[model samples]
Target chain A: MRLSYPTNIRIIKVPCTGRVAIIHLLKAFEKGADGVFVAGCLEGDCHYQSGNLRAKKRVAYARRLLASIGVDPERLAMYNLSAGMGPRFAEIAREMTAKIRELGPFLQPSGRTAAPQATAA
Target chain B: MIMAKAKPLEEILSYLEGFQRILVLGCNGCVAVCEAGGLKEAEVLASALRIQNMQAGDRRDIQELSLTRQCDKEYLAELKDKMDNYDAVVSLACGAGVQFMAEMYTEKPIFPGVDTCFIGVTEEQGVWTERCQACGQCILAETGGICPIMRCAKRMMNGPCGGSEKGKCEISVLVGRDVDCGWHLIFERLKKLGQIGRFAEPALDKDWTLSRDGGPRLIIREDVRP
Candidate 1:
């Protein structure tokens, strides 16, 4: 999905982005986010002090995993900004959308999405 | 910390393409803290997959469940009733979790959401480097806690391999230190413990049968199991 794709991009606001984990980013892609980015407070400026740094670390790890999985690591990103940085948030969105446009829609094997409905064991 | 990269997005995407519903499992242990697999990873992957499906115009239902620990039976037990609800179980835990989940449900396909890399330790914040081979032996008292099984170029038990170049192993540049071999780290540690002599003792071959050969391993506690 392109960042510009309607409702494709989601921003999950947490107590802090550091609360986000690498798998969360992966799941997003697995579920289908052409690109994902985490926007947190500026470095050394987290309201919770270490939260932004933590978010950065998590995003880094997620990007690495995305790259490993054949997903463009560029699909996932982290930015530092205050909660009120509307412009910064928009910038992230624009950047991500552009990246996704280049990568194209998530290409799954078989060009299918639905696995067989899970049957009760 | 093992430097395991996630399976490329294409690979993971392809695996889930045919599945209608997917459950992404997460472990809060090693992978969680390192930002690999954990609650956060489960949520993120779920979200990404959902978006992927949606944007692709696929109507698959991607579900999720994150447990505190996938390696532990007690922890996995939490999902007993919920296991059958999903088409596939995408375990964010290491490879063992995939097998465990597959074993538990026998019928459902279990997938390793996270590629379990190697036995490792955090070299720094969010940095994991492999340290152990888990050859079914515990000889850390000898090597100063540095695992030669993983650190040595040849997984040597005796000492530095002939290929060890200036403390660096021929296997990779990452395995060595400029002035100190990983062996040095182990020696220094043992020396501090006044256990340097223990390093000289030989290790008997570890019995592989004690591990996977035992057949489906089980640790049932009457108090916990019904």
Candidate 2:
């Protein structure tokens, strides 16, 4: 049971993954989260029957939405695991942190960090 | 409910390119039930637009508002006081609602955010099929409650022409499934009820004046008027 995740990773708990609406995920990105991932119960093992399944669909939709607006769809993800899989949870956290690191920091809305354009002499 | 589908983000973005501040309006009517232009959809759109503008290093103020019903004048009037806050309004209602908004707010630009599909019923959670064409005459009793005018590709009242085979309509091939022929469905339903003989009774020529052919027909009921 010796494991650690990135210091920057923050987790928000919901009653069920199905309760994680598409707007909630998008709000994370709008507020400048580099990446977001949903960890729900394993497929066919949802406590509320199809709650996890609904979360899967919502995650997919959020991915498409991000892609449609020119944002990288890879910024969002969905993972299914049983409640007892503590190792899997840590693994997912590590994976998401690594992916976000590779993607680098999200730029501010004021265009301050944009790439330098060459000017004619 | 009036079914509709969201317009592509690129198209919506293009429409808003000229404006810095915009209102992405939603309707809590048919579009709400269809999950097309509902409050959730409006919020999603607003967030997407914000993200888009943020990434592009530009400013876009998108206010999301969901009205009771955009098709109704009383509901649209609620926004009359605050209409000047934005440059234009992107309507997330059906075509009729969009047109009505345009008519109501003649001074402002109104853009449609969804494609009005059909007058239909939800078959399942995410599936909707056309049910009524508003053909102006009610013939559902004779057709076993299945409307051939809307279901049949040809709109044939007396149907199952040469295209019907194996209980599937000819156009089913193009639609990617074996759609049951309209008349075939009638025949089966009537046969089960021991009323198959009704199929032979020719339906008289329908009145075209009551339908769209009459040039945007209107109904005025003196009995209900105040």
Candidate 3:
């Protein structure tokens, strides 16, 4: 892919991408993240059984969420890489950085448009 | 069984800050999947409200309830007598469920305590994604089981919107990431099937009329009628 992303792209290395909750991604967006990405193992090569699959499914779900609120689901991504694929990790980071550049900084609330300011109780 | 979670402590706190008597309500369905505002959520919100009230010296009434479902008539009917007791409600249910509660009890003020994120599954421990947009049109057969409507940044039924650069969304004006456009997924599938030409089939315009648009929709089956 022909793209470059900002260095602000944070890499959260987890034991397994499958363990990354949707809320974590939403929180990232809520806190004003422009984009989010998850790197996992190849289908048959996951360290834990099907961790990559789980991560992929989670990514797909989140992608749609990003789209629903107009941020474009492409902002959230999932990729597969083995522990030794330093190249793959770097590639993902580079690809993500490029995408974020195209997408620019996040605008509006992360998940949903800000609700009409609720009156303080 | 998809689990849902509630909003952070602060989101609800800000909404409830001005109310004098706040009622925290929970549902037993989908929202309970990730613990957003199920019974546990109600308790947590109740406790949090007390803490906030003490801090502010507002001392809101802060009543609590975990109904079978705030979306159902029978379940909401259970709240009639209890409704008159509180000034407002802090709901932990999905938006529809919360609205049903408000509709059933017109006098009580209602507020959503959880954001309805999406119609998705728990792919792993905590990850939920855009599985179904409820576009009222489903075309999962042509592509691999992956849903283009929900996963694609653009809701293009056929092909990726012009924005897909490298398996990511071009719309990311904020955090530019490689475009893995939804069409990219469909293209990958067609490549596997050796039928890239099939992209010409026009995806019918989605009909959202079947969704929440009709306002206060209800479905009752003859077999399940109580």
Candidate 4:
């Protein structure tokens, strides 16, 4: 099925969401991404057994780390969906795009603004 | 191994307010084992500082370096030429390592990126509990291998104080968790060894001089001083 999502969203593929470390998430904002999210296999349905669950914990940890550094924790998020959920993926893309837009550009601790872009990795 | 935790980013950043060229140093010794200060942590800190500086509209040069052991003079010598390039250094080593680094590089200010907690063993993947206080005395043989100095909220040489409730130390209330009473563990261990009678024998007052109370202690082992 052909589906269209927000064009501002850039998707980066990985072997599994669990491979996404806290540094990777912070790098997105460091490089000026307004928002970043990880879309993994549905809960308890990870291909590598518990990769998605691990990713969930990492995402939460990254969120807290961001907050500690004065970055908005809401800018980072995690989502779980099966491989075949094309429509759901598109819907999430749209939802995230709107959320990032509302949050405006990612602001550095020093009050400077970074260009707006949303990333899903 | 020595256990430590990363200092808050805000605190680390505070130490670098005026510094433009900075090095976030990591040690691959005890700190690395505890997942506190290692190559990965150095990279994380460097990245965070860069992002913070970028937001502040300032151009700062931040780099990452990890040594085999910052406490060793040989390992710290690796920074000889590199130290000249940075205005300041943030060490992710324990308190001792940080001081050692500062001693060698007298010109540049060295800040601690992690707060050294204690000598401990990993209880699990992410949990670390203190195990040793380095009191300069060996009492484990008599205590059945459990240390009261580190485990007991109040270091009681001859104890199982009145505050012990259901095997938990009374201080557990303040910590919001059941902390094993060290004496209780000692009692149980002695019972299993058929030496429960030893528990009643009053231990002599501990020699405070052997511990930190006597100030900084040193051992010059001639055999190892090559």
Better of 2 and 4 by DockQ: 2
Residue B87 miss distance in model 2 (angstroms): 1.2
Model 2 stretches astray by more than 4 angstroms: A1-3, A108-121
Tell me what TM-score chain B of candidate 4 gets against the true chain B. 0.98
Tell me the lDDT of model 2 at B128. 90
Query: How does candidate 4 fare on TM-score?
Result: 0.94
Model 1 bad stretches (over 4 Å)? A1-121, B1-5, B173-180, B184-226
lDDT tens digits, residue span B77-189, model 3: 88878777888898888988888888887887788888787788877756765578675546787666667877776567777766777777776665674445677887888
- lDDT tens readout by residue for model 3, A6-109: 34555555777767766566656555556677777777877688777877776676565555444577777777767676665666777776776676555532
TM-scores, chain B, all models: 0.77, 0.95, 0.81, 0.98
Model 3, chain B only, scores a TM-score of 0.81
TM-score head-to-head 1 vs 2, winner: 2
Among these predicted structures, which one has the highest TM-score?
4
Against the native complex, each candidate's DockQ, computed on alpha carbons, is 0.23, 0.62, 0.02, 0.55
Model 1: CAPRI class: incorrect
lDDT per residue (tens digit) for residues A3-61 in model 4 = 99776676778888878887888788887788888998899898789988988998898
Please give me the DockQ of candidate 1 compared with the native complex: 0.23
How do the residues B89-176 of candidate 1 rate in per-residue lDDT, one tens digit apiece?
7788877777877777887888777778887777786577767766555666556767765665555666565665555555465534
Candidate 2 vs candidate 3: the DockQ winner is 2
Best by DockQ: 2
lDDT of each: 0.65, 0.83, 0.68, 0.86
